[model samples]
Target: MIQTSPKTFRLHIGIFGRRNAGKSSILNTITGQNVSIVSDIAGTTTDPVEKPMELLPLGPVQFIDTAGMDDEGSLGLQRLERSRQVFDRTDLALLVASSNIWTEFEAKLLEEIHNRKIPVIVVLNKTDISPPDPEIVKSLREANYTVIPVSTLSGEGICELCQAIIESAPDSFVNRPVILSDLVGPGESAVLVVPIDKEAPKGRLILPQVQSIRDLLDNECISIVTGLSNLPQILSRSGFQPKLVVTDSQAFKEVAQITPPLVPITSFSILFARFQGDLQTMALGALTIDNLKPGDRVLIAEACSHHPVEDDIGTVKIPRWLTKKIGGSPQFTFTRGHDIPDDLSGFKLVIHCGACMWNRRTMLSRIERCLRAAVPITNYGLAIAHSLGILERSLSPFPGLLNTLKTTRSV
Candidate 1:
């Protein structure tokens, strides 16, 4: 049976532009909260600020306030890099600009957004200052874009802009991927293989396990929780064949061998990838492991900060696993939290954690960055499934993705 959380399907609208373009002001006016740091000085908001709130008619949407794109000094370059990073997962790109219209910077940004196939919403902020330039409107329209004129101070055109954002966002996102709850029949069973390793938090299963169980229950599925060692026996003795078996990536090898070929076996990482991102694109990245060389550096990136145990998967276990499977020892580097390194060129492979805390746009944006740098990126689950002998077996749950990966690897 399939299970999913409601929050999984929300429109991720990102507000990006030059420094002090009233991005924060627009966010504050929309959410009616002190969400972004409002300051007259340029570059006050150096990091990406995200706020999740209900937009009328649009429902639950995330407003990501990004740093200035035009700030000049070395610090500005870093901020600009981060702002550019937001474009990858932006369902709707709101290019906040003044009445001056699409400057050279905005034009360049628009080109990048369109090149990635992301929809754009040119928000002409501070309309109260002066009428918007017709040339800017014409330029965007010529490129088949949508533009909305608005002023945060006077609230003029704000309503129209919000409505336009919903209209301009990707047509399919309005329904939000038909959450997993929409997939399975009622009263089915799903077996979850959670390995309780030393790195497994002291008393609690990780967020993915807890959330998956809750989602399955909500979707009217009976979820059986067991560790890797006992999974085979449980499935063997079960009264009915499980509809699905979701295992942690760490046990992909053992779990694959134990699971019958007929059963639809997949890893929590793959499911999470489906739950959180583009499955085919991420799966293709997993093939990068085949090309890894001994001296190449691979970045192991995670979203949360924890007191890592001796057997921490990101630090020790993953490195060991990669070396064992690939037959070469790539220099492994680790990074935690939202800040990705400024320069990613050194790393040939970027293995990211399941970003439960981050919005989809952010994680997808990271994947976009890796692709731009000509590096391959994969998630923990996908990588583990690939390294294990059962990658093809695990992908049985996702037919479309399985076909895509088969095609990509063949290419």
Candidate 2:
């Protein structure tokens, strides 16, 4: 049996260009498959087409071929808008352009990519029909852009294009941050508390729990897995002292009570907040819960779309806790998957999920947006612990963040 990495673990490379610029063709040729519809028509690809595969020397990667940025008309504009959204998650961007053509569309797109601080490679496709313009090439080079002139018809520059992608891959992806391994040293042990609830999959542990266990094993650390019922037994052993205790956010209060105060503790979602996003920012956002007033608007964002169970964490539990904490019923708006509202100004606070389904870049982009909107954003785990008045205790493993929290709380 072969193991496959999840899309969230893969490098996200987005290919962008105007209509018929061979964006799809480049993807098909490089991947050696017809991943996208390659048509001469301007608006053939009305939505972003994604292809996930192993790119050697770069590991797993997902190539996103988007609709033309310069698309016109009512429907065309919609497609163009969807293509623009791809910028938020793109780790590496391929700005495809036809050789001998340098227009505002390509320039404006490049500017947008630059504004986001994303690494971009300029691919002047269709070089067989006409050579690349020297002035355009020189201008791009002067701006420190890697310019690759390619003719997919003749297989020219395909190898070089792949090399450029390999080189431009983000450092974060190459050297990923650990979920919890850094907290526990080699030969040390950590306890993982996973509760079996209605939302828990039939027989499988959740992604965060499984990944944390795997990360511990990979780092030569021992991982003790148990449910809320057995957590007490594991902690009660006289000679057994775990370096850390990680539990589901919902089980925070129980686990904190059972585990000794000397042992550092946290939740899987909180670990993910540091793994997938800025911990300090989310921690600060969690502190803003004290300022939430009655009738204040709150946005709950979930990365994975699913039907609501009876006591769904996002829909029921979090809202109930917030209502109790605020002593009033605040307006709660729920958004699942990629449906984050374009305008976030109406919301007083944005509470998001662990985002296990999304890459770090995507989560960071969302966090960045919330900051720009001046709205405080926090993840489910942080929000839960804070509302329960146990957030400071849950952050024990991360002393720097704990000290920061204490200082911020004093203010």
| lDDT of each residue in 1-411, candidate 1, tens digit only | 844323345577888888888999999998888999898898889888978777767677777899988878888887777777667557888888887756688888778777877888888888898889888888777867788888988999888888887788676566444223333446887888998877777788877787778777877878889988788688789566887888888888788789888788887777767666667767877888888878789999997788888878789888887887888889988999867787898888899888766656667777777878888888888887777656678778778778887887788
> Candidate 1 overall Cα lDDT vs. reference?
0.79
Top candidate on TM-score is 2
lDDT of each: 0.79, 0.93
Write one digit per residue (lDDT tens) for candidate 2, span 49-167: 99998999889999999998889999988888899889988999999999988898789989989999999999999999999999999999999999999999999999999999999
How many pairs collide in each candidate, listed in order? 0, 0
TM-score of each: 0.82, 0.98
RMSD of each: 4.2, 1.0
